[model samples]
Target: MPELPEVETFKQYFESTSLNKQIKNIKIKDTRILSIEENIFINTLRGKKFNSVTRHGKYLFVECNSFFLVMHFGMTGDLEYYRRGEEEPKYSKVLFEFTNNHILSYISTRMFGKLDITDDYKKYINKNRLGPDALTMSYEEFLMSLKRRTTNVKTALMNQRIICGIGNIYSDEILFRTQINPLTKINILQEYQLKELFTNIKEILKYGIRKKGNLATYSSKLIIPHRIEEENCPICHTPIKRYEILGRHGFFCPTCQKEN
Candidate 1:
């Protein structure tokens, strides 16, 4: 799934490549991903110019003259830009052709992503009841959200209702970096531990952004504990362990994040 860092990367890509371009045409290879009627979606965006791009959590909003085109890269979504003679990606669900003949392709191999048209981004976000974005949320806000939550710390972090943008992968990384066991009860966390959690959340997320969401490309130490099964911990040489939490696998160094 495209989490905060990956979505942020896409937002940058969308801004740089697609903004200010006039939509000459739209090719809908799969209408299953469209949230609006096919004709309505096509008619609304066919000739409008892309004004800007913004992101909240994992959603990308492409501003046009009349409305915003919202995108959610569900599990295996990606965007690619190519000019004439370049091959379209294998699972491209939609294509936006600009006046200059360049194309922005929305590709989703598993067809889990979605595209929607809306007039107000804020209204849409409010209607969906999404919490503040994780990257921009303040430490105070993070702490407040944890109040009264008795769920495991990992579950709390992954809850979009409490804080948006974090997913299974990043939540695991956050807990690992903070040396918090995934099974720790949220209400049992100490004040200092909460502060440390907030700090690690910001650091790990910012680091991910700087690396363009490809931790593997940056350094083995950055992703080894999460990317490999049975791999030795980079920090302590202890074998990394995996735990099933909320139907997702979370990796951690047992010695580093031992439950108390």
Candidate 2:
């Protein structure tokens, strides 16, 4: 799944390559991948210029001159930018052809990505009840958001209504960095611990974005590294531990992130 950092990276790319380009056509290869009717989606975007691209949580908003195109990269979804005469890949599920010969492609191997149209983005976001994005949420706001939730700390972190853009991977990394057990009750957190957790969340997210999410790369690579067994904890020398909770894989260092 593309997390917050990955989504932000895509937003920057979209801004650079596709902004202000007038859409000449909207092509959908699979009807199941669209949230709105194919004709309506095509009609809404055909003539509008892409004003900007914004991201909230795991969703991307391509704002046109008059409306917003909602995109959710369900699991294996990504975007590609190519020029005219460049062959569109077999996986380019949806392509937005621009008047300037640039094409913005949405590719999803699993067919889970979504494309929809909306006149009001704010209303749609609110209706989805997503909390403030993890990248921009203030410390006080983050603390309050978690404190109000009664679920397990890990579950609370994953709850979109409490804080946005944190998925299984980042949640594990955050808890490991803060030295908090995944199963700990949310209300049991100490004030200082919450403060530390806030710092770690911001640090991890920001660092991930800067690295272009490259978990492991040879040179100038941007990918999110998935910590697994036998890997050393970046902060401490403890061996990384892997566990399955609620059927989701989580990683931690027992010596560093002691259960509390």
Candidate 3:
């Protein structure tokens, strides 16, 4: 799944390549990936120019002259910008042809992504009950949300209603960096532990954005707990462990993140 960092990358790419281009036409190879009616979706975007792009959690919002286009990259969604006469991506489900003869294609291999149009982006976010964006959330706000949670700390980190943008992948990284066991109860966390967790959340997420969410490019000093089952802990040389937590697979260094 494309998390916050990946979605932010998409947003930046969309802004750089697709903005200011007048929509000349739209081709929908599959209507099932659209949230709105096929004709309505086509009409809503056919003539507008993308003025700006923003993201919240894993959703990308593209502002047009009169409306906003929202995109969710479910699991395998991506965007490709190509010039006229260039071959479109193999999984290109929707193609946006610009008056300048360029094309922006929304590619989704799994068909789980969605595209919709809305008049008010803020209203749409509020309607969906999304929490504050993970990257910009203040430390105070994080503590407040954590104080109200009774679940495992890892689960709390992944809860979109508490703090958006973090999914399973980043949650594992955050917990690993903090040296917190994934199954550790929220109430049992010490003050310093909480502080460390908060700091690591910000740092790790920023690093992710900088690396554009490519785990392979991450430093060996920073462990990638979930990338492989047979990997060893980079710090203590202990074998990395994996187990189910909160119905999702979690990976950690058992020696480093011992359950108390």
Taking all chains together, each candidate's TM-score versus the true structure is 0.95, 0.91, 0.95
181, model 3: CA deviation in Å?
A: 0.4
Task: Summarize candidate 1's per-residue lDDT along 55-157 as a digit string, tens digits.
Answer: 8889988889869999999989999999967998899999999999899999999999999999999999899988788999998888887888999998998
Against the reference, the lDDT scores of all candidates come to: 0.87, 0.81, 0.87
lDDT tens digits by residue: candidate 2, 4-71: 88788888888889888788988888889998899999988898898987788878888886689998
lDDT score for candidate 1 against the true structure: 0.87
lDDT: the better of candidates 1 and 2: 1
Give the least accurate 10-residue stretch of model 1, judged by summed lDDT.
Answer: 218-227
User: What is the lDDT, from 0 to 100, of the residue 193 in candidate 2?
Assistant: 89
Arrange candidates by TM-score, highest first: which order? 1, 3, 2
Model 2, total clashes: 7
Local lDDT at 86 for model 1: 97
User: lDDT tens string, model 3, 226-251?
Assistant: 35687888889888888887777778
lDDT of residue 191 for candidate 2: 83
Better of 2 and 3 by lDDT: 3
Which runs of model 2 end up more than 4 angstroms from their true locations?
218-226, 234-236
**Which candidate achieves the best TM-score against the true structure?**
1
